[model samples]
Target: MNCTSLQELGVDSNGIGGKIPPIIGNLSSTNLSKLYLNDNEITGTIPHAIGNLPSLTDLCLDNNMLEGPIPLEIFQPGWLTQLVLANNQINGEIPKSIGLAQHLSIMDISYNGLQGTIPETLSNLTKLGYLVLDHNQLSGTIPPGLSCSMILDLSYNKLTGQIPDGVAGLSSLQIYLNLSNNLLEGPIPLEFGNMDKIQALDLSANKLSAAIPAQIKGCAEVEYVNLSRNFLQGALPSSIGALPTSLHVLDVSFNRLTGMIPQSLQASPVLQFANFSYNNFTGEVSSEGAFANLTDDSFLGNPDLCGSILGLAPCSGKHGHFLYIAIIVVVAIAAGLLAMVCVVDHDLMKTRLRLTAPSIQLSHFPTVQGNATGKKESDEHPRISYRQLVDATDGFSEVNLIGKGGYGHVYRGVLHGGTVIAIKVLHQDHAGEVIAGSFERECRVLRSIRHRNLIRVITTCSTPDFKAVVLPFMPNGSLDSLIHGPPCGGKPEGPRQLDLDLLLGIASNVAEGMAYLHHHAPVKVVHCDLKPSNVLLDGDMTAIVSDFGISKLVITGARDPEVGEASTSVCNSITRLLQGSVGYIAPEYGLGGRPSTQGDVYSFGVMLLEMISGKRPTDVISEEGHGLHDWAKKRCLQHDVDAVAERWLPRDPPSVLPFGPPRCEMEVIVVMVMELLELGVACSQLVPSMRPTMDDMAHEIACLRDGTWRKYRATGLKAIDQTKSKKY
Candidate 1:
């Protein structure tokens, strides 16, 4: 190839793997303007010879596996316009000469192991607009003369000292300014109030102290603020409560703030997530506006704060104290009178008590059954009547049905109040007693458990002939639809519409939900019916675990008394007399081992594998025999991800071209796929004891979601080094 004539070499976003050949640098094309070999699995040190391309204007070797210090020689190109080497393992300090590239406008070297103080010469890049140095080991105080036209992120670093006052003059700063998770201490710079257009500001997890300046309200466009986990003292400025209407999140927990929470904050309509926990605030906790929907979890650790919120004491007044004393006197007087009357007419009183006791005892049965239904209802989730639900679902029309399960049909409903909801109606049958019992059990479990990844039970309706569970409407439908692309009915076609990050995110969410059920919730729940269809997706594509129809409550050292006779019937119904749904049941569960957390883990593993490989477990038509786990285990042994990747990736040459959407490194994808398959194999072990806990599975999936699997692998490699270096 005549290399001198080449102006560009684009091999980005393909399934290319392995190290970038050093010989490519031999091109030395004087006319080369762009080197687009990014988003591939190319490893090893970037060839220093590529610096010889004097005309190269853009270098895009990002999101790859290349390591080692960036070649200082690359900075020789004065005409370089953009340099994106982010999300790689490249170490060593950024070259001081980087500022020599006068035309450079973007430099992102984030999420790497780069160390040493950020070079002060960076301030010379007048045209630099985006400078990201987050999630690295960089130390030293933040540089002072950074260009105003940049989105500066020095978060998750060891930077110390106060923020530079010069930063306040940067009128061009508009996007984000994050200096969180650092060792920085001192008062927040008053100049920060000058960034009128800044959208997000996160200065949390620092040693910074002093009251938040009232001047910060000047940031008119700021939408998110997180100043939590600091030593900041004094009451939160009242102005903070009145921040611009654009603000959505304000978290200032773990501080030394005192006094009543600003009532203005309670009135803020746009604020969604606010935390004031672990503060010295005292006063009546208002249940108006934002506080109306907030639970006690948001205001815990403040003993002096009383309110109408559940789990909090109601405010008491002088008159209330007098009323309590008067009630006590009246009760004492009535008891004495009753005792004298009983003594005078013992036989007559005994006969009257016998008649009344039976009626009272009969009423206690319904009270016990109601208690079995779950915690008391709150205004946030008021009990909806069967009639209201019927009207909301248009008299249970089939056209409104969104899904179906053994419990009943899930129909999309719009109430008279204009609230969209998902109403899950239960089937009334000869097993009326069993259905009612299951409904109570479901209510018990759902009411007691609350997490971001767990489905929220809005309200429930029960009648002699019908029962239903109401939940918030999930617009994105189910993870099953997003994973398998749905079965006809005018759903969008082609790819499953899930990218690598999104798929891992979904898996992580499901794992998180399972982990919470297994270990963190008020009661240990085993989601006996865990499958793709049971996982719903919200508008933000977040996966929430749903359908706890057959979930079992596990109590340590004893069986749950609440789960009594009803659970036995539920277990039979859910396990399909023994085994769960084909392709998703644990091996031991089929042998009458009973529902446990390990069973849920095994089901998650199978669903995870099925998601990666487009084959259903029931369709076990592979040469490996058994099901998806067996086939994936065979593929894992062969160390070939392509066997399963073929089911998801486009095979046509045109579709695989460089200009296509960015893809995760096929090599990284293979590693992730292999690890996931190994997870399946581990969870599906014949002996239940050999399987990993749902907690472990959840952690692993979280690691994969955040791109930390490689770091953990690197740490494991170091452990090997430590073992080998030890004396024999």
Candidate 2:
């Protein structure tokens, strides 16, 4: 019993490459607290008798190819704290009995093929500091009793349910709480708001629901908060306005919520990256102070937002009513002149339109091309003939009509040799001088850009009486169809019912495309109108940013005041022009006569959140006093947002029951949803500059997917191992 300590036993030196000796327990001594028989090619299970060592404190059997469950005898005692059985092929769960070790502190069973739920008994270790069970096959809820306060990372696991309320209240949680890409649910606990000592909190890609708690506003000491891809709702709490000025990053995209953005958030001077896109919000936007310096891409997708940011239209109604009346009179006079010209040349105009109608079945022609000739353009650009477009569209046949917009009707057509294309014809009644200028400007911008995300302009045709722009056909249709229409109806079946993965993929791709236009394109392009309808999906579900009618292509190195003034004036006119669809139009466009990229970012954020939550941003506004973005944001702050899941998930018996026979892992799915909500919250931030660039958005989504997939695979492996071990 008083045997001396066992010297370092190098198993690899003995050439013992086969199975571990079962009788090796004889080496155990009362004073043998440290056993290091690692770095060997040894195989087979550890001996049970080794557990009889009452003095054992450190047993590191790492870097070996050992297989089978850990010896039950080793866990029976309660003294061993530093058990490092890592880097091995060991199987089975961390036994619940191991929690009996009241003295255990550093238990790292990482890099092993271990399976099963984490033992709740481990919570009894009051002295535990670093508890890392990452990269394992652990499935089930995080034990609420886990006492470690510093760093408790159960990330990259199949754990489900909300982070237990008790766990969020842990006293040692000062550094971070990384529960990204898990099956966790429920709103982030408000108790976490009191953990002001914590630095980073990442609960992204989970099924957590409700709004980010206002309590967190009290955590002024926090630096980073990521709640992306969740079911969170509501406007960001005004309390967030109280965050430490040192806060650097915040993301809450892809959720259901809405409201007028708080001015306090927009004024935050320290925010570098923030996103609140794809949600429902409506209000006038101003880019003074911290917001003015940001790019237009930051505020894409919000139709009801407007400001003076670069790459965006000027706010509408900025000019007095006299100016509006003057413009209207000018347009009326121009219309009267055009009408007289039509009357004089009626026969010729009719004949020309008829001749070209066959090529553009979906278009009415006269609206899009009629004014192109009178306008100035670079002579090098090719001019398409209206007759060819008419011939392709077969005189705007009903069958060829794909969609209708306030500006014009979109038509599908085939050219002479079978070249399939889309034709966008402007409305004839709006073909006055002002409207014609907008048409020409759109065509000019579309012609110069060539990006996979941007809708390509194949050609354009203009005449005294007709106008049209030809584009390549989009087989997968528009994002609007998927987000707003019934999936089962229509030729393309509208938009497919998307799971969390698919939603994240589409949103990320759209963001990437937008980011390219705003930041990477040779000429900075502001996609002034980035609604769901403007996002087209191709055969493989690849998204292409479309609708350049409101797009602005800024020339590089051009500081001409005339250019700036003209662009600003045109943008201001367009904002007040009532051109965009009613609900999707930015608020400032209706009142302020300004359009900024921040407005677009807000719209895009709304679209993103709407897609993930399966709610209409407009519906949230009209039916619900609050919009979807605000609702989701507020719910995230609460702990009861999971109730919204009932609306989206199948309500059948098995689906509703928590632990039914046909359980479909709905809880896990909900966690993924919450992750998405967090993304939406980020995109919908009041401060446009707080939003992440589309490139960053895409990368975050990819990271979530990778983490989720790994956890899923690990869980499946654990189940297989458990069944096999039971049979033995």
Candidate 3:
């Protein structure tokens, strides 16, 4: 019989359902270069002989029920470049023969039962760019020679040893380099500073030691660098000041460093997130430049270090009164000159400007209402008066206060027409000359946005000294209050116990609100701060996202500046100046200060995780070890997630249990909780790109809810059918 060519077969989403054909290996003479068998219910083991096709360059067997180890014969040729065998029940070690395929660039073996050491030979592929070996039992040292330039994730494994020195030579590395939650040891290689284009570097929760190498200052393009929970020692490098303005995140907590912080390091405007806590550093902490904004928490647990940060003891010793005197003398001299100039030149300046200026017609302020001709008479736009807002907010009384946040306080008020509203008043400190422009930008953006999930910007008031926004009131309060506050008091049971269904419902709504802001709104708005507190719920429990004070409107068609190449350090500095609260801010924002859609996704992911875990993102448990994400992931892999969920949400059956079986209700709750936990795990993935988009997350939650409801309904129908058959 003539052997059929594999090319003769076309299996691209043809709805072909069933197991892999036993005779698949017979097509040995096929000239096929691509084989896609995704989106099918194909089952059983992959045939060993199936790898005989020498011309195969792209093989996608994902979204299938395929099982067994990757065929060793598949790695024989150098033609293969893309191998996606993910989302399968595949097991066994990756064959070392994979290294022979020198052209392979993208290999994903995630979400499998794979085990054993990573094949060192696989590192020889210099062209490799994306290598994912996550969520496996892979063990042993990472190959030193593997130098993929893009992303190299070896998380959620039993991998050990120091990061190989060859990794430092991946000069094309841009997005991230994560080797967290591993058994890596020894000092971080000084050679890593040579990766000039590295964007984010995470070596947290490892056993690495020694002072952070001064050589790191040479990584001019690096934005985020985390050395947390290491045994590092010695004072920070003064040369850290030489870092390019792109640097944003610098964490060296849980170390043994000492001595005064380098003043130069503190002066860099690009440094937004810095945590030198739990160290042995000594001497008076300086607050000259960017450091002036940092509080004791940034440098906490270092008893010997003193500063002016609130809650910390003030610095003692010498008081410099002469410097204060000199500043007063200079100000007095300038004031005297200003008074003389005002008296002598006031009339001269006005007459000179009128003579030199062009004559123009003046327009009066426009009326608030339109005329019969459908044209406004004045040029001014409608502006809410400050007094009107004050009256609406009951003279800014404390009783009206609903919530307080980093930017300002939110108040619940009722207008004269009985329209309930939320009023936000700027904090006194941030209400300065420098913030006036930002206030205007926010007003302009909020007024233009009119989405259901987004908090409606009814009106705003802006004066030289005061700025505030009026919004529709949310009577049910914020999600934060419900999750973290004391139980509601009116009912016999103190606070209404939060069931899994209710929690998932609220999470779905929050995701929907975030999705609208990220993709559906007229302008792409990044709600820079996305946490429980920012999500408000109305009487019907519909979630509405609030707080746009620091939100950014991403202009369509505008290209983000190249990561490593920008005109001025000022741009990077300006970006870093806007980093929001600690727990919710994306890591990238604290690294290079570059903002992207991924940043908002990361924040959303954190919130999703928080909702499921019923724990604050910054809660002490999270800070002690891996975050809630890591905790949930570990439990999920072990199939013990139900026990973990029960810790946060009790499963006590209702006393007046309905007519339905109690066991059935318990099972429904268990399944719902598990689904929510899985969603949380996906959202808080260590890799920002791996996290689901808000739109996808919302859809997934909706499916979970709908799926559960359908199952419940079907069970009821089945019971009725069984009773009818019994009667017959």
**Best prediction by TM-score:** 3
Q: Model 2, which residues run further than 4 Å from truth? A: 1-384, 486-495, 555-557, 560-566, 577-593, 640-664, 706-728
In terms of lDDT, the poorest run of 10 residues in model 2 is 364-373
lDDT of 1 by residue, 626-656 (tens): 4565567655447666666544443434322
lDDT by residue for model 3 (1-728), tens: 15445453435333345787756555656676666675455778777766767777767676566788888887765587767676678889999888878877767676578889988898688777657676678889988877775567676678888878887556666556778667888888888778886767878778887777888876777777788887877878887767747677778888788887787778787676788899888777676676777887888778777766654445664353345446658979999999999877877877877897622111222223332123453544334577877887778898987665434567877766666778777654422533443454456456446656767665566565677766677777777777666333322211344445567677777778778778887667666666777787777777788776556666578543321222133233234232213346565543334555567777777776676666765442213323455556665535776665565433553332321244575466567767777777677544454568889988998898678745764665566566658878
Checking candidate 3 for backbone clashes, the offending pairs are 223-591, 249-590, 366-378
Q: Judged by lDDT, which candidate is best?
A: 1
Clashing pairs in 1: none
**What lDDT does the true structure give each of the candidates?**
0.72, 0.64, 0.65
Residue 648 in model 3: shift from native, Å? 7.6
**Candidate 3: stretches off by over 4 Å:** 1-383, 428-431, 486-497, 558-580, 620-624, 636-639, 647-660, 713-728
**lDDT tens digits, residue span 387-412, model 2:** 77777889889888887654567898
Look at candidate 3 and tell me the lDDT of residue 298. 89
lDDT: worst 10-residue window of model 3: 358-367
Please list the Cα RMSD from the true structure of every candidate, rounded to 1 decimal place: 25.4, 27.8, 26.6
